[model samples]
Structure formats: C-alpha cells, structure tokens
Target: MKIAASLIATLALAATTIAAPDNKHGNKPNKPIVINKKVLQTSKVPFIPHSGTALFTNWVGLNVDFKYVKPVFDLVNATKAYGNGTLISRGEAHITTIPPTEYDNILHPAGVTIEELNALAAKNNRLQRARFGLECLGRVQVVTKDGVFQQSVQIILKNYKDILSYRNDVFKLFVKKGGNPALFAADNFTPHITIGFKNRDIFIEDGVYKGKNACIHPIVAK
Candidate 1:
C-alpha cells in the first residue's frame, strides 16, 4: 500500500511541474517597452529672391528664400505695438555657415581663400538638392554690432543635415590644407534666421509676445 501511495504522489508532483506557467520565455523584468513614434511631415516653404543689403559682408551664409520666411515677418510686423524693433529685410535672411572671425583666424591662415571655399561648397550637390524646412520660432538676446544686448526673434531651422554636413566638409578641407585641427575644433553651431530685434524689456516666448504685450494671434509657419 505504501509503495503504491508513494508512486501516486510522485506522479502528482510531475504533473504540477508540467502544468506550471513557463516564464523563461516571457518578458524579462524591468525591460523597457519601446513604442514606435510617427514622424510628422513638414510643409514645404518656397524661396523667392529679395533685394537687400547683407548684414555682415565678411560672414558667409546659405541664402534662404524670403517667401519661406515672410509669414513670420508679417506676424511680427502686425504686433509691432508690443515693442519697437527693426525687422530684418528680405535680403538679410540667411543661415550663417561660417562666422567672420573664423574666416579671419582659421581659413585665411591656412591658405584657404574664400573663393576656393565657395568652389568647394558649390561642388556639394547634396546642399543644392536639399529643401529647407521650418523648425520653430524662438526669442534670444543677441549682441548688436554696437555691443549692446538686444532681444532678437529668430527662426530656428530644421532638416538641415545637409548644411551641417557641408560645414564639416569645409572644415575637413581646411584641415587637409594644413589647418590646425585643434583650432578647427567643433563649435556649438545653431543655424537660425534672425527676423528682427526688439527692446530687452519686451517678452517674446517661442516667437510670441507674452504677458502684458501678448499678441492676439499665434505665429504660424504657413
């Protein structure tokens, strides 16, 4: 009787083991669940040439189409009562790829003339083919040519991978021509289009006037 009972107990134990839920193949503890996010499509803004003087003759930049940025200017102009500031003319809009100081200190010393640099940039077919996209509008305080702090409204650029890559290639070209790698160190380049400058006291947040002088309408890219 005892032997028979022991055999039955062992069989029951085996059945329980077989019936148990197998977690070895299940999700591991503390593992993060990844969600695939959808990429938003950006609207295309067309470019139209406008006649105006360059803000900095010594600075080199990629010219932006004025028609692409006219809406922002119009919005700011409509809300000029919020604060007094000068709007950047259509011709002044550009993405500054290289600053004036860098041209004088780095490229010139390395025997990389502006003409040669332009020729190299022109050869970059990717830049010519890529279309520009609007990212967002933001307000920042910038120093004017006269060395005074002025609040400026700027259009931050997006889909600018081609521009950034071109700048890196330009640096590499200079370095290949015997430029110092240490002097040509990477900079925190924020490619933006300055629309206008306003009084320091005026509060413009993310391209909109805020607080007492708030704008009635929000700035739209269209």
Candidate 2:
C-alpha cells in the first residue's frame, strides 16, 4: 500500500505538469492545462493494477524446460521425424506453411545485449549462443489452491536495474542459502494480461532440474 501510494503520488505529479507553451505565438497564450492524475487513473481503472504494497505478490518464477516457439517447433519436429523415416508418411498433401507473426513473443527482436554476448563468448568451446530476457508489463505467475497455474507478463514499465539486481539476489539467495527464499519483485507496478505459466514448485533445494519444470520461464535467468 505504501509503495502503491508513493507511485500514485509520483504519477500524479507527472500528470499535473503543464507543458511549456511555444513562444512562436506573438500572443503568448498563458493558460495552463492542468491534468488530474486521479481522473486519468480512474479512466484507466479497468487495466490491471499490480502495484501497491498489498496489491502485488512477487515470487521466484522458475521453469526448467521451456519449449519456446512451440508452435513453430512442432512443425519442424514433424519434418525431422519424416526425414528420419520414423514418421513414414508419404502423403500427397502439401505442407501449409504459416508465416511467423508477432503472436510468439518468445523470440526477442531486440537482439542480444553486448554484456550477454560477452558472457557467452568468455566461455570457451561455445559455437553459438543466444541470451535474452524480458521485462513484460503483465501479471506474474501464481499457483492456485486447486494446483492450477497462472501467468501474467504484461508490458508493464520494467525496472532494468532492479531486474538485474534481482537476478543476482536470486542467484545468491537460492545458491547460497540452499533453503526457502522469499521473493518480492513487483509492487503495484501494473498489469496488462495474463501470459502463461508452468505452475510448479520450481526451486526445490534438492531436486532435479532445480525443481522447476522445463516448460516454464524463470523469474531470473538460469
């Protein structure tokens, strides 16, 4: 609540700011348009409000195996199986190819960062590598009482520094502590839409694949 209130206040300040008028007009119009943060927020109230102390719950999201771009990969898998003579399908049907679209958000178009590329290059005997991370404005993953899993990764304004710091903290906490760790990532930041989730206790201190399912994405880079 405190954090949310603070953010709201900050946003309110920005909302109230008046843009300087252009001096090109000889009349020098001086009427300032005042913006009401409250009205703006109210207007956009239907959007998910993930910020604020009590409103957001953060967790260390973990996924051991992620079949990213599964739809595309599924097609490729079929081709490989057919070539290997395992599929044994010689049908006259043509392969209907669908051009990739933006629906698959896993493929990062921003490309790899210099730091990430360097990290991989520093390791010897690696021919190719891709390092990418996402700062989405959506809901974080959560587990329901019925064992169902949910995901939310909207295009929320992400804090890059905080995320990097969180990654480090996640590493140290999970690696060094070797016990139950607390995760407090988002705070009334905001929410857009529910993305997806693997819905499993990922960070098992003493389990295979670090106790995370391979199909889930990790809160921090693994």
- The model with the greatest TM-score is 1
lDDT of each: 0.50, 0.24
Tens digit per residue, CA lDDT, model 1, 182-208: 787544466666666554422222222
Model 2 accuracy (lDDT, Cα): 0.24
User: Clashes per prediction?
Assistant: 0, 18
**TM-score of every prediction relative to native:** 0.57, 0.17
After aligning candidate 2 to the native by TM-score, how far in Å is the CA of 122 from where it should be?
35
Give stretches of model 2 more than 4 Å off. Answer: 1-153, 156-159, 178-222
Q: Which 10 consecutive positions of candidate 1 have the poorest summed lDDT?
A: 33-42
Stretches of candidate 1 above 4 Å error? Answer: 1-56, 80-90, 124-126, 142-149, 198-222
| Top model number, lDDT | 1
